[model samples]
Target: MTATHHTTVELAKLARVLDRDPGDLAFLATLPPEALREFRDQITDLTARREARRMQRVGAAAKIVPAPIAAKIAEAAFGPVLAAAIAGSVDPARAVAIASALSPVFLADATLTLDPRRAVELIAQVPAPMAAAVARELISRGDYLTMGNLAGSVPDSVLRAALPHASDLDILQVGYYLEETSAADRLLTVVTDRVPGVIRATHNAGEWPKAITLLGLLGPTERSKLANVVAAQDDEVIDGLLTAVEEADAWDTLLPVAAGMNPQSLQRLAQRPAMQNPTLLTKVADLALTQNLWLSLLPLATHLSPTQLHTVAARVATEPDASLTTLIEQAHTENHWPTLLPVALALSTPDRKRLASLPVMHRPEFLTAAIKATATHNLWPAALPLLNNLPTTTHDTLATTINTLTDTEFQAAVQAAVQAAVQAAPAADCTATLIQILLRQDFAPRSRSLTLINEAGNLETLVGTITTRDLALWEGLSDIRTEIPGHLRNLLAAQATRCGRPELADNLTAT
Candidate 1:
């Protein structure tokens, strides 16, 4: 349940125990549910104990009268509250007989005042048909608290008969007010096929917080089933569900269910048009950071359009460094780099730099995992920008890992870098960074690496990077001059002269 709804449920129960309107006890809503429940239980126990002697006397008298007469006297003289108070003290069989004789309306009235804990045996013995009748009466009166209080104590046979008379909305409301999670679970089991209708009813009624609370009360299997039912709804209903969760700030309850859904259902939910709302996406991103829900969230995020994914990336960029570090570590641990790398690529240059500069990004294991994920997912196109921004401290580790890539992997990285350079503006920092890292490493197949760079036809940007960032890179090219095809050597030498680096140009042409 959302925290607000949980507190409201507790306050209502507490109000009933103290005989106060729920509004009068609104001040207690800030207290935790457990605290409120404890206070309610103490008051209920004290009240029942204090009234035990008088109620016992009444019970003894009711036994002497015949059941039919006792029912009349209790309704006419004692009233529902007094009648309920004496019920626990009566013999279980005698109580059942008396209840059977009373009209359903009167029985329903007494149920409102009855404490199920005190009358468990009597409630259990009531005939299923009679229980169903009282349930119908309570449903008509919208007395869910009374129905919820007694729902679990009655046998499953009673629920089976009684629940069909209640609409989906009625079931949801009663589930909300149910005092026991086990009761809610039992109720869900009896009405498992009604989940889709209940979800639609909840959406139509704007009762998502109640539905989310109900989801939390079920076991994993039931929760997944109900979540998929919600997922299967059309965009309008699904959007309504998201809006309600946002309004209630109830993502904590909804996210786990979203995470646990079967793959097809999860993808359907992820691709909904409502999932692209920037405001909602921002909130969910923040929640994921705080709750360590990235493992759950990333899979869903992968299904968003490029535009929508960038919205999420922009939000993630605003998080602090420590938060970014946690996200990176989680991505590595969960092997979610394939999912996260795209978001990193989508970040603005400055934000990408911030992500790359995280301390965790410098760790050998994290860098290795990132490289492996890039190779495995064939994600080098997206990985290049972030890799380009990584701190120089990590270059050796990155270079070591990159050099270990198989022939196919190495060529893919080279092709991706060349493509990034060709596609980027003149600065081409991504390709430049890759070249710089390669130049620094004891890269094997040096001839093959240099050959790929020469053949890729992006020498102007690479040469400019060499001149501005590290002129010594020209000597590395000089050493591998044989790998440079003659025409490409002329192209690089001419571009170098154009940049007024004639001496460096001499290195490419001389050998």
Candidate 2:
């Protein structure tokens, strides 16, 4: 569970003990959930002990009275609070008989004051029908805390009968007050088919926080089931879910469910119109960076439109370097390159360069994974620009991986770079980075690779890059001069001369 929702649940339980509104103790939200629970337990213990002797006296008297008469006197004279106080002390068989004879209304009244720990045996022995009756009374009165307490003690058979009487909203309200995840899971297990209706009702009632809190209490299979149901809802429901998270800043509560969703369901959620909202996208991005939710958010990000991807990328660009480093390491650790590469591609050039300069980017394993993912994802256009910005210290590491690519992978990179150059202005940095890697490889493969580049009509772009940046590229090319066709070599000489590199022109001509 998220800290925000956990703290809210603790506060609600504490508020019930004090008979105050949860909002009345809003200041308690500043305390950790453990402290809140400990304090509430201590107070409950004190309250239970305060009337111990008096309640024991009532119990002793009730043992002698017939069940029906005791039920009447307990309701009419003892009242609900006193009746509940003496319930735990009564003999289990007599207590069950007395409870069965009382009106559900009176029982419902007593239930609110009954501590489940003290009356567990009596609660378990109550007939299923009577328990359901009391549950219905609590539901009608909107006393979900009492209903939740009863739910914790009742048999699964009783809950199965009782829960259908409550509306979807009633279930969520009751779930919010449930002190045990096991109880909430048991309650939800009995009504698994109702989950869709419950989610729809949550949106209609604007109770997303409560719905999300209920989601946190479910076991994994049920949690994923609920998350998928939410993902499959119509646009309005999806919008409400986002609105609630944004309002409460509760992305932590929602993200784990999202991370667990199947790809199609995740894609459905990613395509929601509300997800494209820039402010919401930025908030989610910031939270993901700070909380290490990239494992969850990145897959969803891959399904976003290009415009939304850019919005998320811009937010990511503004985060601190340490956070950015963690993002890269997480992506590497999870093998989430297919998910993360597009967002990285969406960053502006300067931001992309900043990302490429992170120390993690220099690791051989990271660069190798990146190169492999770039080919697998057909992301050469984006990858080339970022690769151009990698620190020179890492170039040999990148080249080692580049040199080991299979014939198909190596040719794919060459063809992709050539295709990129043809479709846009000459990418000088891309050509130079490829040349630098080629220069590091053995002659036979480098010659074959250069032959493919020449056949792809990329000699002009290559020569242009060599002339403008490093005349030494001409010297590197001279070693494989025989691999260069006569016409392309003439083109290289003319460009080198045109760019005022007479010595490079001579070197190309000499070979």
Clashing pairs in 1: none
> Cα lDDT of model 1 overall?
0.80
The clash numbers for all candidates, in the given order, read: 0, 0
lDDT of 2 by residue, 1-511 (tens): 3567779878887887798999999988989887998998889789879988888988999999999999999988999888988999998889989988899999888887788888888877888788789889889988887787678778888888788899988988888877777887888788888888888888888888888777777777678777888888887888888778778777876777787789888888888777878988888888887786778788788788889999999998998899888888888889988788788878988998899888888888999999998777776766787777887788778777876667677667766666666676334357777877777767676776666666654657555555446656667777767777677778777887888877777776783
Model 2 gets an lDDT of: 0.80
The window of 10 residues in a row where model 2 has the poorest summed lDDT is 420-429
TM-score of candidate 1 versus the correct structure, residues matched by position: 0.74
User: Over 4 Å off in model 1, which ranges?
Assistant: 23-34, 53-103, 118-130, 152-158, 180-186, 206-209, 212-224, 245-300, 330-336, 376-378, 399-422, 425-511
Clash pairs (backbone) in predicted model 2: none
lDDT of 1 by residue, 227-248 (tens): 8888888878888887777777
Best by lDDT: 2
TM-score of each: 0.74, 0.79
- In model 1, what is the error at residue 481, expressed in angstroms? 8.5
lDDT of each: 0.80, 0.80
Off by over 4 Å in 2: 1-15, 19-34, 50-79, 86-102, 118-127, 152-157, 180-189, 212-224, 255-257, 290-296, 375-378, 403-412, 425-428, 442-468, 481-511
